[model samples]
Target: MSHVTARVSEGERDRAVELVQQAYADGLLAPAELERRLERALTAVSAHELEPVVADLPDQVVHIASTGGRVTRTGDWHVPRRLRIDSEYGRVRLDLSRAHVPYSRIDIELRLAYGGGTIILPAGASANADGMRTEWGKVICKAPGRQSPGRLHVQVTGELPYGRLTIRRK
Candidate 1:
């Protein structure tokens, strides 16, 4: 049998409904459309029924994981509402200076074992790294600790062991 005909668990149904709700919250779905999708998602029995509910919505979370080597994202890339980067041993360079960020606030969660992370924020932006914990490293924030009103705010969180996280603005 095809995946579309496979049975869907309750968790899958809940995820579909949540995706529709988030799409509405993100202004991608109208009230009537969201209601329609939610109803369909709640009633969905198989993967086929739920597949189209949020097929066009942007992903709520983007996760990048690596075992080693360099992991970088720069230039005009779409910055998601939430980002997760996990690496065992690699340098992470996320340059948001020339990126296309639609949201006012972006949350970045990083978990590194033995690699350093460098995040270059766009101008007129600030960051808060208070929630980050370093077991044997440091977290540096060159940008203002508190984000200003009407400006972009980057909230950094997660853990870094044996490596540092440097947040700066260009």
Candidate 2:
């Protein structure tokens, strides 16, 4: 039987472009290849079309959403280039001490509504919470310095409304 191809969403296209750009930035792709992949990703209409654009990229984008309850990611999980977390009346935790971070940088987007969470990273990793915002909530970022060469750099972005976000190094 012939498999049906799923249509590509705008987010997927954008993610593909981001991956291509990241690969180019990381020196994994040549300028011409980056241009070609970006053009393909931008004009992709189906998942099949977009797959090849990011197939050679080493990083991925993961999205986790919770309506209510607790969600946690720990242990030796593969850390994607971009991670988006959404919680509504739920608690979320990400422990990245043992995570496999292939890239030197990662971006995390958080959307917490009436919920709180904590992020535990390795001591060698450095965190940037400049893009994060809070309203009627508290965000405690205790990221230490002295980043090693080629260490992971995490950029935390997004909003927390009436919820707490704590980033600590272990």
Please, what are the lDDT tens digits per residue for candidate 1 over residues 26-92? 7889999999999998888888878988788776679999999899999899898789999999999
Q: lDDT: which candidate is best? A: 1
lDDT tens digits, residues 1-170, model 2? 99888999975786678688888888999999988888899898899889988886877559988899888989999888889998999998999998887777678999999999899988689888878888898888898533467787788889898999899987
Clash pairs for candidate 2 = none
Candidate 1 collision pairs: none
- Write down the TM-score of every candidate: 0.69, 0.67
Model 1 CA deviation exceeding 4 Å by range: 1-59
Question: How high a TM-score does candidate 2 get?
Answer: 0.67
Query: Model 2, which residues run further than 4 Å from truth?
Result: 1-60, 145-148
lDDT of every model, 2 decimals? 0.87, 0.85
